[model samples]
Target: MRSLKNAFAAALLLCSAMASAHRFHAGITDISFNARTGNTEIVHTYMAHDVEALLANLYGRQFDLTDPDDQDVLRKYVEGRFWIGGQDKARLPLRWVGMTADPEKVTVFQEIEQTPLWKAGAIHDNVLIDFIPDQVNTVNLNEGNAVRTLTFDRNQLEQPTR
Candidate 1:
């Protein structure tokens, strides 16, 4: 009976430790067409702690996302990892709109002017996947009343926009 109690206590302690150490590594991206602007806008949302950890791992130093230079670094990194291809398989000209960061979350804004959402053929989003193997990204395609979703992970980085 005493041994059973000891084992139960050990299991409880182990479970608590594992729960405290585990953190979710995920991001969400939204691609939507704006009729008023005649553009396709993209927005990415991620955990602020995860972004800071990624920046620190890449540059070996902490980054202030509010600073232009730091934001540019993150922009370049994101651009290289995520993009939309045209029907001809050519990459679209995705302009960086900007980004916002608070204590808990980081939001990035991008847009392609004069392009319809249906014009996108393929999407490649592997943001933070290289740095964190467990990272996963979900892209939501919002077109009119219909909505579609594509998930990206370490194994699947690119997928047809349709």
Candidate 2:
């Protein structure tokens, strides 16, 4: 009995430590970016599972997760501000940002934190970010100063092809 208790206690401690070390943050999902004529278009999405769990993980409280409300909160924040390249903030800070949602989908487009593809771990969710905002713009961007850590589960990335 004592040996069993000792083994359980050690297992519990190890599990706790690992969980703390890798609490899921937030990051971009199903995202694509394109630029045209000095105007940039950033497209990113959120999964139904992400909004509640990831937000609660980061903020320590469950936000009002209504489809429309969740979409709005996320859209406004990304549109209003983003870190881009060497610039201090949103490269093309929008005058306005918009959100629209159906039962289980949210989409956003606005100025984004843009970066080059060579960056290691340079993308995140909870915000919109564009890659190579200008093919001819000739500016090399870095991802060293991202605002939030985004998490994409291996399970999702490894979904069985249908």
Best by lDDT: 1
Candidate whose TM-score is highest:
1
TM-score of each: 0.88, 0.36
Q: Could you give candidate 2's per-residue lDDT for residues 6-103 as a string of tens digits? A: 99999999999977863433334332233333333344444444444545665687666445676566555554433232223223333224554344
Q: What is the C-alpha lDDT of each candidate?
A: 0.95, 0.39
lDDT of 1 by residue, 11-71 (tens): 9999999877647799999999999999999999998888999999889999999999999
The TM-score that candidate 1 achieves is 0.88
What's the CA error at residue 22 for candidate 1, in Å? 4.9
Which residue segments of model 1 deviate by more than 4 Å?
Answer: 1-22
